[model samples]
Target: MIVDRQGRRFRNLRISLTSACNYACTYCVPDGKRLVAAQDELSADAMIQAVAYLIEAAGIERLRITGGEPLVSPKLEALLRGVSQLGLDDISLTSNGQLLTRKLPLLLETGIRRLNISLDTLDPEAFRRIARGGDLFSVLEGLDQARAAGLKIKLNMVPLRGQNLDQVLPLLDYCLERGFELRFIELMRMGHLARAGQNFQQQFVGLPELLALIGERYEYAQADAPVDATALRYKIAGRGYFGVIANESVPFCRSCSRLRLSSTGWLHGCLSSSNRHYVGDLLDKPRHQALPALQGLLVKALGDKQELAFAGGTTIMKIIGG
Candidate 1:
């Protein structure tokens, strides 16, 4: 029942299954150290309990399972196995596709019909240079396998100047041809990028420039999106849809209804804020005892949401999930 001053409430929850990532993408990890799972990550059962508790506590209607790379998390299948029966409106996953092919059967059996995969470029060298890890061939093959498996896939690409900005159009063509939605996420001033100063500004790309690049080959118009949807959606005439998560040019903080829970059990209300509420212990407590405390904490979490623009934060996106 708690809503922010801007009328935003927790309708969507993104839970990070693990903090450990297989890839050290340049944008995500400026220092090039791969993230590792926290020593105290919650067990699969406890996380499932939290999801159920939150359903009643905050009226969460959607769930996105994320990770340092969720496929790398050993608890993924078990977690999904338990979460699938909860009857949430939808359950999706976000991954780097490094292990999607291996996990496709688990995803299908668990009824995960849609997912978001991060793929910035199709070039092998660029993939290595940017992701800093993983085989692009494996990822590409995984994508094909998932597509053939009848999964509704969406591709996420962060457009950065001097990095893979040139790949935007080709990547879009790749998505459009395959019936996958391509989402161009504008680079944010987050993590080390927050302190990157001129370098951050230099490499950062915005919506106008992204549209201009895509406009060179195709025409598109603004399309409808959920009120709390982060990405601004668009649809082309003959091609499939594309979206722009223009955090810089068109901040959607006012309508942001996402609540992030790290694998080790911390509720992050806003990505741009450092504040986090610890609800791990509550997950093990009785409902009567946990519900009251968790609801109180949910209010604090909701209050932590940004009022307008995303000012950015020092916390790495992997720590809390993307």
Candidate 2:
């Protein structure tokens, strides 16, 4: 199996197919900004081939498809089918859930068994305002479709101060009632808004406090893993189970077994670090040569993995697939 320098096993791979997104979330793409042009992006075929190479070389067991909005990628179902054919043990996708209502069945048909949908607010107006142009009803419909498809669905909530924090209890209530997993992710220090004036401390909320509040009705089950995961999973006092992911105010740099493949074909060794290795350039190289080079780079980066320097820093969720 391929192992990076920090002894972090390379088992999970997150690949971003495209950087283009339909909605301009206030915290993500923001209001007015030009996104990456489509002309310079990798085609579907190239992405599949690259994934195949990585799997063959590193023995990667799980793959996650992410993007500005993975569903928006033209013929995304076809692309997922290609990845499914690779025989990876787990194949998942993280989407904004806007287009999922219409494509849920098709995605399931393509062998997508897991989904993590981003939904920050329960209010229609708040959803529209934060997500820019998203309709809360559409996202809810998509959630229903996912449940109907029997896929393991997780709700990804980004809690921003003065934004969606007040909805936490409501989200938990929804999850407990619906038997869905609720993951409250703290905003990371990478994004158009974060760079502008988003205060990390003000927006930051610790996992312990969040879990304590939920403790009123739930009992947490901590994982044995070493990674600093924010998702404090728990059973809702014989009712149901859910989780929370805290990225800020608490960092999980060590034991980070995940690697990110950007839309541009760069492999990010660590989420907090800007260091990356280009895999696209080696696409044409012989497998014998390319595999070792890729492995070597990963190993080196793993060794270099450092703890997050600050509560907030670079590395947006979109860039690496939140």
Candidate 3:
């Protein structure tokens, strides 16, 4: 096991393929900023090497490909194929769904079986306003295509207090009606909002209030969650299941077994922790030659992992994949 100083074993790895996204979401991508240029990013072969090292050295079997928008990556299919060849137990993706309709078939062919789509609002006007000119119809079409492709789908909604908070019921109803799992993510005090000079506290809505709102209409019970999962899953009476990722109100630092690899190749042991180590540099050599140094750097990062849970401060979520 790849155990940290706090004894949290690393089993999940989230990799950012690129920072270039089409939509400028208010919560995620504020001003259409790309941390690293497309040309300057790592190649598919390098990503394959990075994943191999993580799986062998860190014991991470579950992988999730994320990005400013992963579907938009020119080499996405190649990267997915490379990682899938490793025989991983689970290969999933977190995307904005702008290009998913066109890419779903290629994605499934490349071995992506699970998808977490970011759909904040059902109202087209709200979507355009929050997502900065994104088409609600395109994302909707993408969802339809994903369902038809037989992929497990999860809807991720970051409900800000004044923003999409009112659309919670509509969003949940849409997901429940379609038998798609839904997860409500609390507004994290980091990334685009911070960079935009927006206060997360002002937009924050804790899980209690969210659940209470759902409880008014249906009886709900807590359900089982994955060993290292941060979301608290629940089953509602007469309704489908849903979850809440209460990172701000109730941080899961104690059970966080996930590691983040930025598009630029930096290793982050904890999401909110600013301390990062460059693992990309080691990818230039053969896997056998790079293993020792990669293992050392991962251990160093584990030591730097946060002992206590705290709100995110410095890291950009888009750069590391939210």
Q: How far is candidate 2 from the true structure (C-alpha RMSD, Å)?
A: 2.6
Return the lDDT, model 1, position 256: 92
Tens digits of lDDT, candidate 3, 173-286: 999988899999988767655444447667878999999888877788999988778899999877779999998777888888888888888888877777888977798888
**Model 1: lowest-lDDT 10 consecutive positions:** 1-10
Pairwise TM-score winner, candidates 1 and 2: 1
Task: Please write out the lDDT profile of model 2 over residues 59-142, one tens digit for every residue.
Answer: 677898998788887848667878888989889999989999888878878888888888888999888778877689989888
What digit string (tens of lDDT, one per residue) describes model 1 on residues 117-151? 99999989889999999999999899999999999
Sorted by TM-score, highest first, which candidate order results? 1, 3, 2
Task: Specify the poorest-scoring 10-residue window by lDDT in model 3.
Answer: 29-38
Error of 3 at 215 (Å): 1.3
Model 3 CA lDDT for position 314: 66
Assess the local accuracy of residue 282 in candidate 3 as a C-alpha lDDT between 0 and 100.
91
All models, RMSD in angstroms:
0.8, 2.6, 1.9
Score candidate 1 by lDDT. Answer: 0.93
Q: Which run of 10 residues does model 2 get worst, by summed lDDT?
A: 223-232
**Model 2 TM-score, all chains together:** 0.89
